[model samples]
Target: MIRYINIKNIFIIYLVALIIMVVLKGDLSDVLARMESIIEQRNEGNWNISLKPFESISSVLDSYNRFGVNIVTVKVAILNIIGFLPMGFLLPLLKKNNTSFIKTMLKCLVFILIIEIIQFIACIGVADVDDVILNLSGCIIGYIFYLIVRPVIKS
Candidate 1:
C-alpha cells in the first residue's frame, strides 16, 4: 500500500542518514576539503589500520587505571555499538531475505567489513577489528529487538 511505502521510504532515509553519521561523525560543510585532506594523508602514508582487537581497549584500560580518563574510548565503544543496533533491526525489515537470523548477521558482517575497509583506505578513520566485534554485537542486539517488536506490530 502507499502508506506502507511512505513509511518504509522514511525509515530507509533515516537509516541511511544514521549510517553516514556513524561512519563520518564529522563536519559536512567542507566535505571536499576534508576529503582532500584525507587523500593527502593517504598519499603521505599516514596509514593506520589495526587488526588487533584489544589494543585500543587495552590502552584505554591502561589510561583509566593511570589517569582515570576514559571518555574517548568509552564513548567511542558505546557509540559504535549504539550506531549499528538500528542497522541490525532495520536491515531485516528492509530486506526480504534478511529475515533469516544467520543470513542477516552474515550480511551485516560483510557490510561492516566493507565500511571498515573504506574507512581505512580513505583515511577517514581507523580500521579496527574491535569495532567490528562491537558493531556486530550491536547488530545482534538490534535483531533481538526486532524479534521482540515484530510480533507485537503484526498482531
Candidate 2:
C-alpha cells in the first residue's frame, strides 16, 4: 500500500500541532498578562515556585484508593499522558534511519522543560514537574502506538 505522507508533510503537521498545544495551554491575552507579571516578578526577584514532582500523581492514586478512580483523577491522568502523543508518532515518521530514540526523547525532555519553565515563570499554569514526567510517559505511549501502526500503515 502506498501512504500519502512524506517527511515534509509530517513536519508541517507536527509543527501545527505543537502550535495548537501552545495556544490551548495559554491564550494570547492570558499569556501576555502572565508575561507582564513574570517580568514584574523577575524584576522584584519574587518567583512563584510550585513544582510538584509526584504530588499530583499521588493525589490521584490516593483518591482512587478512596473512591476507586473518579472522573477528575482519571482526566488528570489521561490528559497529561495523551497530550504529547503526537511527538512520538511524528519524529519517527519525519526521519526513519537517522532518528535515534534516545536523542528524540532527550529533545522532548528539553522542550518540555522549557515549556514548564516558561509556564512557571509566567504563572500561566501550575508548572508541575509531574507534567514533564507524564508528558514523557505520553510520548512513550505514542511511540508504542507508532510502532504498532507503522507496519500496518506501510502495508
Candidate 3:
C-alpha cells in the first residue's frame, strides 16, 4: 500500500513537471518578459493561432521539400505526439477506477486544450490544432500502453 502511494506521488510529480515544461518552456523570468513585451507591443504577428488542422504538418512538409531535410521541423511534430503520452498513461493510473476510452480521451483533450490556450495567451508558441491532434495521438498511444501494462502490474 505504501509502495502504491509512493508510485502515485511520483506520477503526480512527473505530471506537474511535464505541465511546467510544456507550458513554460523557458525560464519563468524570460517567459514573463516576452509576455510583457508582446502585450505592450500588441504584435498581431506574434499571435500565431491556427484553427485548421494539419496546417502545421503541411508547413513542415513544405519546409522539408524546400530544405531537403530539416531535423527541427520533424522533431517538433514527433515531440508533440510523444510529449503527451505520459498524460494519457498517468491520468488513468491516477484515477481510482478504470476509465473508459472515451472518458480517458476527453480528459486528455481537455488537458491539451488548456495547454494550447495557455501557450496562446502567453504568446510563447503557435496555438495549433495540429498540435492538439498530435498530442492526442500521443495520449491515445499512452493509454494503449497503460492497457498493456495494467495486467502485468496487477499480476
Candidate 4:
C-alpha cells in the first residue's frame, strides 16, 4: 500500500473523497435554504460591498468606490479559484507518467464538472454558467503553474 501512495494518485483520492463528503454531509433542502437566504439578503439592500484593509487591497480598500467588479463576479471568481486550485497544480499528477497534458486537463475538467453537478443537485449553490468558466480558468492556471514548477520538483 505504501508503494501506491504517490502525489498524483493521492490528489485524485483526495478529490474523490471530498466529493463524497460534500454529498453525504450536505442535503438539497439545506442548500436550497442557503440560496434562498442569500437572495433575500440581496433583495433587502443589505448586501454591502464593503472592502477590508487586507482583503480588498486591489480595490484600494474603499467601501464606496471599491473595485470595479460586482459582488456576483467576485463570488464566482472565488468559487472558480477554489475549485481549480488543485487542478492547476496537482491535477497533472493524476495521470500516469507520459500521459498527454491535454488528456490530464480533460480528466480534471470532467471531475470538476461532476462537482458542479453535485452542487447544482444539492442546491447548496447556484449552478451559474459563469462558474464553469471560472472553474475551468482556475484549472488552466493551476496547470500552468504546475508546468512551470515541474522541473523544480523533479530536481
Clashes of 4: 2
Each prediction's number of clashing residue pairs: 0, 0, 0, 2
Against the unseen true structure, what C-alpha lDDT does each candidate score?
A: 0.79, 0.73, 0.82, 0.60
How much is 1 displaced in model 2, in angstroms? Answer: 17
Give the per-residue lDDT digits (tens) of candidate 2, residues 53-81: 88888888898999896997788678777
Candidate 3 per-residue lDDT, tens place, 1-155, comes to 77568669977787788787777778978788867765655555545578998888999999999987789889888888888888788777776485677899998899889888988876766688999999999999999998999888667
TM-score of 4: 0.58
Tens-digit lDDT string for candidate 4 (25-130)? 3576665677676567667964423223234434322533655657764663575567566766775654437435687668767876676676555444444444
What digit string (tens of lDDT, one per residue) describes model 1 on residues 20-46?
A: 875677777555566677777768976
Which window of 10 residues has the lowest lDDT sum in candidate 2? 1-10
Clashing pairs for predicted structure model 3, backbone only:
none
Top model by TM-score, which number?
A: 3
- The window of 10 residues in a row where model 3 has the poorest summed lDDT is 39-48
Question: Per-residue lDDT for 154 in model 4?
Answer: 62
Error of 4 at 112 (Å): 2.0
Q: Pick the candidate with the highest lDDT.
A: 3
lDDT (Cα, 0-100) at 5 in candidate 3? 85
Q: Give TM per candidate.
A: 0.78, 0.71, 0.84, 0.58
